[model samples]
Target: MKAELRGLPKDLAEVVAGHLVTAGMLIDDDPELAYRHAEAARRRAARLPVVREAAAETAYAAGHWDIALSEFRALRRMTGTDDFLPVMADCERALGRPQAAIKIAKEARHKQLEPALAIEMLIVEAGARADLGQQPEARRLLHQAILDLDDRRAAQLGLPAARLYYAYADVLEQTDRPADARQWFDRAARLDAEGDTDADERRDLLDGMSITFDDSDEDGSDEDGSDGSDSVEGESGEDESDEGESDEADEDEADEGESDESGSGQTRG
Candidate 1:
């Protein structure tokens, strides 16, 4: 990045570099602020690929999809690589142009991309298919992508395996295949050491795991038990007695309340 900035006068380059550094620092925790920093850098160094890439990423993180799409498009043109296509397609998807996203993914498929980028493209394309109500086609696309990947390499290469599995599980759940979805969510959770895909939470949800809150009055002076406790919270007898009934209620609530995002974002390598 510093090398790219060498074209500018020394003082100007230092200022732009500082903005890029600040953007990178704030991106994960405060994306809007990060985007402001990145925009500051881009305004001064608009011709640099590194600056454009920073701007594109911060915009994407801040949920400014149109600006992200435009900046990523500029990065592609300047860098002469297809590295941004997956994210660009995703930006198109976010803008409610699923067909445009699919078209970009189609173009991406013919290009020689790295393994991770290829997987991201496939994932984005599958999502676009789902958005268009082509659930079966979406499932097939992700299924084939998973099949084509080697499991060992997926684990060792630090690939987006968890996201892939989570996306598949999400589709299965959407399609009313709870049993299959749970299985895939379990697989995703196993690979998701970083908790990137919320797979563990999803699997627990499918398993009907939940906490039962004691809704007794805060005065701690309600409910009946053989023991002299104010509430049933400490009554192991009542809890044990109601265990089976509680399980049914939990399952019902899980079914009605669980909502999921599409999938994890593309790994920002």
Candidate 2:
């Protein structure tokens, strides 16, 4: 077994060494540092497809979009495989070319990438469409993504599910369906909360819904007061009671806001 291992290729050995170095840098929370290691590995194993792919991924994570795109493009040309298409799309999106990203994502889907990855590409396409104000196309893509998730046997889990629901909520909100958006936001919040994934993001979504509810209440109250003032000549008991309740609610909201601020300060400290 030792002799057989020793006979293993030098190129593979260099690639493995690069992976280890890159992984170490990644573990240190330094993507830029890791990217250097990956680049070195890519240089040493230029003919190795896996090394190029790893280098591209690390470069992308390091926010070296130009380098990542170049590496991915090279890999695609060399292998003629769609495996790197989504990564290319991500690079394009980061570079503010959402339409290009959408196109690449579609090509990835055409190549029949994994269902999960395909769904992600669809989500990206939808977001790009939405950014371009193609609301109908965005909604259609989102609906298809939801249907795909529903048909899957595995229970939707983790960041992907959270993100999908969040995206759906955003689309609903953009379409002026606050009630439906709130439902989807609630679902996303619950999923993220349960998974312990970026609890602050989930909290923000819930807080936004709370603010929306407060705004709706205020608008309704103002409309009712205007109608009552026009119809009645004097201050009424019902109006007095409504004013008292509104004052209480405002005080409660103020207290909650203070508590939230205090909690955030403590967390930061």
Candidate 3:
């Protein structure tokens, strides 16, 4: 269908097709550029629902949450399909409207969406609930999603699984469960390792683990200086050097005072 559409010689078709391909190429490397292409496509073919969807996706990828939301809302009205609900919910979550995300996800769930999409909705729902301080509800939702995925043998959705784990880790961290958060983060890292190897994803996962371990070491050191005994010893050595300097200054002052007193006595005599 895409190839047939691209084969058309009409100026609108050419512009739309060109922009669509360009938008996809720019999505990973430069989402802002992708958004521009998608916008161009929309301007060229305002009547095309797919063009609008592309624009919404590009906007969301570029972190323009408001623009993405507006485009998605327009698309939703035009198509009345639940295909983009997960992305819409993600935009809402990013914009700090977690409750709105939860509502959207609930609608998606009622529509009997695809398993991956449904799981994504559940993840967003959990996140929103967590943000609103509904801890038990959030946990229940997350656990339900996890169990559903497990039953479905959805490790095939490794990327989404990794994202879900990272989200769980974020929530745990916010709730002051650093140890548990680290475990989730570790899971995310392992999942990423097992999945596709995009350069950016690999770098992010590796860096995340490195930072986590570094932070753990720092925290452990603070709790029990045994972890940083070398650092402590070095600091102690510096302190001793400062004390020795102070002692030398005190002796120098005493010697100066004695010389002044002796000179005064000699002059008086």
**Model 3 — TM-score against the truth?**
0.66
Q: CA lDDT of each candidate?
A: 0.81, 0.63, 0.68
Question: Taking the tens digit of each residue's C-alpha lDDT, what string does model 1 give over 119-223?
Answer: 888889999999999999999998888887777976864438878888898898888777788888888888888877789878766654433455454556334
Q: After superposition, how far is residue 103 of candidate 3 from its true place, in Å?
A: 1.5
Q: In candidate 2, which residue pairs get closer than 3 Å at backbone N, Cα or C atoms, i.e. clash?
A: none
lDDT winner among the candidates? Answer: 1
* Superior by TM-score: candidate 1 or candidate 2: 1
Residue-level lDDT of model 3, residues 58-133, one tens digit each, is 9988999999999998998998888788888888989999889988987886796876677678777887888789
Compared with the true structure, what per-residue lDDT tens digits does model 2 show for residues 100-134? 99888767755868655665677777778887888
TM-score of each prediction = 0.80, 0.65, 0.66
Clashing pairs in 1: none
Runs in model 1 deviating more than 4 A are: 211-269
Error of 1 at 228 (Å): 16
lDDT of 3 at 178: 54
